[model samples]
Target chain A: MDIKAYIDSGILELYVAGALSEKENKEVYDLMLQHPEILQEVLEIESAVIKLTSAAAQPSKTNIFSQIKEKLKFGNKEVKVVSIERTKYNWMTYTGWAAALVVGAGLLWTINQNNQLESAVTTAEIEKAYLEQQIEEAKTNLAATQNLLNVLRDREIISVPLAGQGNFATTYAKVYWDKKTNSIYLDAQGLPEAPEGKVYQVWSLTLDPLTPTSLGTIDDFNTDDNKIFAITNANESQAFGITLEPEGGSESPTMEQLYTLGVVASAP
Target chain B: MQLDTLVSQFQKKDEKAFEALYNMYSASMQGVIYNIVRDQDIAEEVMQDVFIKAWNNSASYAPEKGRFFTWILNIARNAAIDKTRSKAFKNSRKNLDAEYFVDILQTSESLEDTTDAIGIKKFVSKLAKKCIKVIELLYFKGFTQKEASEALDMPIGTIKTRNRNCIKELRTIVLE
Candidate 1:
């Protein structure tokens, strides 16, 4: 058989793409194992396609496997509960107590079973709510991400990379200043969590005279997953800075606590 | 072989193996779903459902029939297409034109984070229109050779050879 000719026929690409029929796929599978070159070619094609497709993907905000794991875990627990009930039923028939005691124990067992069943129903409800909540969250996150992408892609939006400063040199951030909307999207993904009673405050700066205007405190920094906050910035500023301040922020910019600073490249 | 082992373990209901496979292909599946549904939220819902369905129907899978990646890819494509056809989806999203996967790849925000960022950019920029359509139909859309032939208004044999050549170019661009 002419292996090179067979390979050139492009059957392997179709095979990897699953465009082949069952019989054709089986033949390709058999040939792949038989010939190292065929197997190698198939692997390469698959890898390249995987890379191409993955480049288009926007990954989920939360871990999807954990959700699957939770589902599988729930299934296993239900199975175990069923088996335990079966074993308990088998033991119930072997009971031999006096009539009165037996009645009393039976009532107690009934109550216990009823309580267990109630709790089981409650658990199932909770699980259902949790799953529903997760789906809702995923939907909201996706929508938010899409909106963020659109905003970032806007032609008029200016990108400012705020480098870490002073003692907080390890932390950094970015500001997407949209002049049209009078808003700046601050992406503080690189900043560490604000300590208790301390909130990160943003500021618009004037470079020549070295003046600053407070842009308010980030109270929900700990809760935001992306750490990208959109704050109204109507100021015609020259630079941007972030400072750690006590909760509710301070009157003036805390220059000593300034965590990051960046000069706007094309400040108007 | 490692993938084969992981797939076999996944077939045996091994969570670890399933997780490994999910991590490996979830991005690709998301990309495929995103390309079809074109809505990130709907795509996400379809992606989760696809994997859960794959896990539930794992026993029905046979290695001889096709590769595991191909199996999951089929599920993703079918699920996304099904979502588009759903009444709720239709009502919410009116008029979903047939868009190529190349558009998604080029305009994707997360492109830089992908391992194939540079190669993919180069490939898409350099790829001919014919190659894009062939790849979009055959690979991303899971179109059969005949369907792709009809879609591209080309012969089946040409579809096969063209897909082969396109993939060959892809290999050079991405796997080199």
Candidate 2:
């Protein structure tokens, strides 16, 4: 068998690539020991393959030896005596990785913490608006009560205590008449809750003539927390009366449905 | 160290010999693994595992069965293919298109000035598409001549002779 023909047969290339069967490998191994040229040919093909494959690798800064050594725990003692050139390479690659990780982790944590704090601030703002509404309501109530006290203290004001009358005699009311402002503050706290579709209408009356004039109805009587209603009364009234009327105020006072009546004492 | 001495020492669990072999074939193993997995980090991870496995199973290697380079190349290819089968790797890569090893060689940024790099770039740039597939299957992917022949739709003899002609063209360019 000519060795050159065997070399040219391309069987050795497949042999180096390990693309042959086990038996074929053994044959090639025998042939290589017998012939140096075949052996040299195999070496050359293997070398070319090694270079071709290695060139396809991506560029990497990682020192694979150091990584393997770290995993195997074999290089730490020998790490000291490692060449200065390798030490420099390890320094650049390993420390670079460590620093990047630390910075990245710190940024992520801070962003999460900031988001939590922002939500807390939003909740606080909503609570603050609610509290401010309550404070405004309290201030308005305090000012209103102070004005009522001042009107009652006036000597010129006429105080009328309207007593319950007729079949609806359980309800009573007080009327404070300030002749100067022509406004009467009716304290209807003693009045019972009006039935649905019914309202309490006030009437300013002249007692001698038996003439009744409608003032107006209290539409929000049931829902108002402070039942003191302020109605404008410009008439030089002899008496103040309240009676139940349907929905809107009546054209004339419903005398039989009268709830309360009061004669003004010394009308100024 | 000689090829026989180096492999014999490696088989005997000589740490220095193992290190020497790693330095010799690390980049080639990485390239082959990267070609299959198509990810640099995963390729490096698989490359490390292949070497560790080679160390652990050194007793199983027989010279009559194959060359030392061929033996490790088989390990690297097997390990990389196994990684691709894993759920983690499959989920991370939804669409793994078939890419030639020449695609990696064309990335000039990673190209070093070594004779291997220059010769490989020249050989691959000039390499026929059919030749690329043949070498990829037989050498890089460790497909048998029959499997390669069936895959490329050629006869068994044609796969051998064509591979011979391709490597012959490669040696003349690289050996210079």
Where is the poorest 10-residue window by lDDT in model 2 chain A? A75-84
Pairs that collide in candidate 2 are none
Q: Could you tell me how far off, in angstroms, the CA of residue B71 lies in candidate 2 after the best superposition?
A: 0.4
Put down candidate 1 lDDT per residue, A223-245, tens digits, no spaces.
99889999999998789999999
Q: Whose TM-score is greatest here?
A: 2
TM-score list, all predictions: 0.55, 0.57
Model 2 score (lDDT): 0.87
Clashing pairs in 1: none
lDDT by residue (tens digit), candidate 2, B1-176: 39789989988888789899998998888888988898888888888789989988999899889889999999999999999999999988967657778888887567767776777787888889989999989988899988998999999889988999999999898787
DockQ of each: 0.47, 0.47
* DockQ score of the complex predicted as candidate 2: 0.47
lDDT of each: 0.87, 0.87
TM-score of 2: 0.57
CAPRI-style quality class for the chain A–B interface of candidate 2: acceptable
lDDT (0-100) at residue A21 of candidate 1? 94
Query: Residue B67 of candidate 1: its Cα lDDT?
Result: 81
